[model samples]
Target: MKIAVASGKGGAGKTSIAASLVLAKRGVLAMDLDVEEPNLGILLGCSPGELRPVHQPVAYVEPDLCSGCGRCAQACAYGAIAWFGSGLPVVNESLCHGCGVCPLVCPTGAMREREKVIGEIRSGFVDGAPFLEGRLEVGGVSTVRLIEATIQAGESLHADDWIMDAPPGASCPVSAVLREADAAILVVEPTPFGLSDVAGVLEVVADMKKPAGIVANKTGMGDLSLDDLCRRFSVEVFARYPFTRSAAKAGARGVCPYRSEETWVWKTESLWRAIERRFS
Candidate 1:
């Protein structure tokens, strides 16, 4: 089973809770699918061992090929191929979805696929448990593709269970990760903004028909509550973490407070049990 720990927005202690969940359970593979801002390694204090580049096929037009039928340009669903009615059609690498349609549509076989480095996947261990992470190259437009690659790489571990720290929000990247997960743990702050943000995520979870529970973080820092939102979504609040100076300090230092605080460890364990009961 893969449990995805995600949020509607960033900085709601999602990564912190994910790291704690890994620590609370044994034999669970830890995977960080947040390619854009991957910091689960920092929080877990695990440095990656091998960095392997992830490549994707991008359409390349060969100028030497005779026919400029413009069919490749017109056949592109993503508008990645631009034909100026001149020498050669321009293939926008960023806009290309790597669908390989251009080559199929090309009458002259001018279009071909070339591998492009979109991101890198790294493997490591956190306390003897396998950990995997993906980091997208700067200016790379393949967020969902990289996430898919990361998930594929994680299968090498072949662990009994997995916990993924997904990117915040209900974007394609998050959806890709959630599609591979058995359930989701939505971490949210008890604030108006948090409630509003998580509402979108709940809708996505509901649409995907995935079981999800809310982990309210920074409780007492906000006046608003998640009661109405949870009731509307029919998602239970599995756990709540209080706002404390020490937790804040430990997080700032790239340490999960659950490692030091007894209360935090108990709370995390309780959360894990609740999840197990609901999904087991």
Candidate 2:
């Protein structure tokens, strides 16, 4: 079963919940799909091994072969190609989606399609569970491509269970990770910001028609109640983690706080059981 843990906003303990879930359910492949800022390895206490470059098809223009025609620029719907007065069309690597339209529309055969290394996939093991993560190269714009590569890396492993720690926010990267998930675990806090962002994330999940539950983190921070929110949304409250100093310290030390009996380990364990019951 594939379970995705995501949040609409950052710093809501989404990664914490995901790491705990993987620890509770051994043999589950944990995937960190936040290519922009991957923190799962820090919590998992494992360094990424065997880094492999991930490439995506992008358009490359040969300046010498160009006729200065604006056909390539006109054909690019994404505005990836721009003609500079009389010079050949310049390709904006960041704006290009690699749709192959520019090369197809180039009249002088100046445009060619080639692969560029935008990011890389790093795989390793953490506590007997396979962990894979994607690291997008600096200034690289192909997050969705890197996300697909990360998912593909884990899919190749074929583990007993798969838990994906998706990137925050309801964008392409988040959608890519949640697209194939059997279920979703939305982690949020009790504050207004958390509640609002969680609602947005729930909307995305509802659109995807994926079974979902909520894990409310930092339970003591706000007066807001999740019961009413869950009832209104018809989503279950899967788990709750309170604000604790030890938990924070453990997290800072790159350790799973769920391993400590003083923390909300039991609650997270029950959450994992509920997920297994639902997915199994």
What TM-score does each of the candidates earn? 0.93, 0.93
How many steric overlaps are in each model, in order? 0, 0
Root-mean-square deviation of every model: 1.7, 1.8
Per-residue C-alpha lDDT of model 2 across residues 1-280, encoded as one tens digit per residue:
8989999799888998998888877788989898899888888788987899998889988888989878888888888888876787788998888888888887888999888899999989988778999999998888998999888878788886888999999887899988979899999989989888888888888899999999888888765888777876789887778878788888778777876645666887789888877657
lDDT of each: 0.90, 0.86
Clashing pairs in 2: none
Candidate 1 at 255: error in angstroms?
A: 1.4
lDDT of 1 by residue, 42-149 (tens): 989999999999999999988899487788889999898888886688999988879889899788878999999998999999889999999998888788999998
After superposing candidate 1 on the true structure, give the runs of residues whose Cα lies further than 4 Å from its correct spot: 66-69
